[model samples]
Target: MLLLATGDVIAYSYAPGRPGFLSGAELLRALPPGAPGAPGTPGAIAVDVVAEDVMAEPSWDMSPSTMLELARRARSAILERGFDGVVITHGTDTLEETAYLVDLLAGRAAERGAIVLTGAVRSLDEPSSDGPRNLASSVVAAADGALRGAGAVVCVNDEVHAARWVAKVDATSVAAFSSAPFPVLGRVTGGRFERLSAPPPRPPVFAGDPASDVALIKTYPGIDPVLLTAVVDAGAQGVVLEGTGVGNVPVELFTTIAELTEWGIPVVVASRCRTSAAPLDEMRHGAGLATRVGAIGARGLAPSKARCALMVALGTGGIDAVRDWFRKL
Candidate 1:
């Protein structure tokens, strides 16, 4: 098994007298060499570590280009080295989105090995730092045979969550990541993974590079239509709307959505609420207008995931393809 260190795995001294992250070299040196067996103990199999920077620093400074580069490198290493699994150490801030992107790109490769993402809410210098344990649990989950074909998953705080559904809901707690409206795939307790659900399979969505020109418009009370128009005028190829309950946009924005659809721009509607799926049925006036405007419903996807999927879909094909992809989701 291979453990890929992409910034967050290591602690860095960002400033004087403050908590810090582990450096890649430092983190590698801290781990015991062996296969990850159970959560608390190291396995008997061989484990290797590699360091690469997926971001400039451990903060929320990630770019789409950086994520693509990291994913490409990880994929190459996994395929070329015949590693049984790859455990990625990432920062918690944008881990969910980056993991989803990897899942979209590497889901089919899961048949050969697992791709598990893990990180700490607290830096290594903190008194109650969770990095080492999270790292161990991630390795255990990655090395387990049960994870084969599970696609990309986030293993944090001893819990394994599918990348598509997991969100960072808290900023301080060690147990910050959660999967709602979906049960976790499994948990890593006592140094071993006990499966609760099978890992999901997601095929690659785009053959070429991602367009990366999509925009997310979150609707609030009395938001100006010009904001939506400005996005289009600024060359956004697709848009994801984080609407009110059940995917409802302000009634006034329906015509704007219709215009965008008519102008060949794809629009996806996702709800701000986290619990339920987005139903586009005409049960509400706003949703009814959305249905009429031909905006795609995000189904069970969160806003960020919907944006990523839209970006991939739009870059690969166009409006029709994005609609089909959302329909299936």
Candidate 2:
């Protein structure tokens, strides 16, 4: 209650057709003249948390324009009003990324009050919408301290997920995000919090420059080394091969990647499908052994999140640190 909420409007094509528009100004203006429900709702105080438009602007970190203002207000609101928590409205395009970023940036204040991230599918103009519900639940979750630990959370379409694992997998479904490699921490059913699992200790996050030159290579039929070689020539600091099942790539492309590794660039081996990773157990020859030489394994991480981890690793001290960070995450 009396929670601080942050909102952003996406300015890019987040999915197939329509762009991910945060529409913060519109939502702020439509905030029910006050928090949802009757006046003086007991045990809950609600406040809209508005932040700047975080224009991801593509291949870069997107942050709301009102981010700093929101942060200042959040710290002030919590310390001054003795409120329960904070809720954020972010674009699904980079919502998870931003959520985890804020979680780390906010430090241990993460444990002090709930900081939940929520987003919408249709524009606010649509009917039978989920925006209001999602926003309300975030406040509810925060007020209930469902966001008290495990870093910032992305609460949407009745599902509560960790920011680190939440991604806009589906472009249009209300249930756009899925918490892969993790379980749903809770859900909103019948207007109340239904926690199925408590979050584990949040994984370590070493944020690298979002602009870092990193590319993920997904092996496919007729795969050619020319494309991968192009990425390496483009000055990619790292390469993530989204190889075939069990981390096998075109035998031809594998050699190219290996050659890139030999050139001192870090080549990370990951899988393109499912929760599988490069066959660390099969590091006997070919790509398997190439992984043995210097390739880092993304270990069950989705390609997007793996890319994030790799960027962070590249920004860190060195290769060993990067390897340890990946293993830990």
- Using Cα atoms with residue i matched to residue i, what is each candidate's TM-score against the true structure? 0.88, 0.73
Misplaced by over 4 Å in model 2 are: 1-26, 32-86, 97-109, 180-182, 189-192, 205-211, 276-290
Which 10 consecutive positions of candidate 1 have the poorest summed lDDT?
A: 33-42
* Residue-level lDDT tens digits of model 1 in 213-294: 7899899889887788899899989889998777778877888889988888988888878634535653554354686777
What overall lDDT, based on C-alpha atoms, would model 1 receive against the true structure? 0.74
Query: How many residue pairs clash in each candidate at the backbone level?
Result: 12, 20
The per-residue C-alpha lDDT of model 2 at residue 90 equals 61
User: Top model by lDDT, which number?
Assistant: 1
| CA displacement after TM-score superposition, residue 11 of candidate 2 (Å) | 11
Off by over 4 Å in 1: 13-21, 32-46, 55-59, 201-205, 275-288
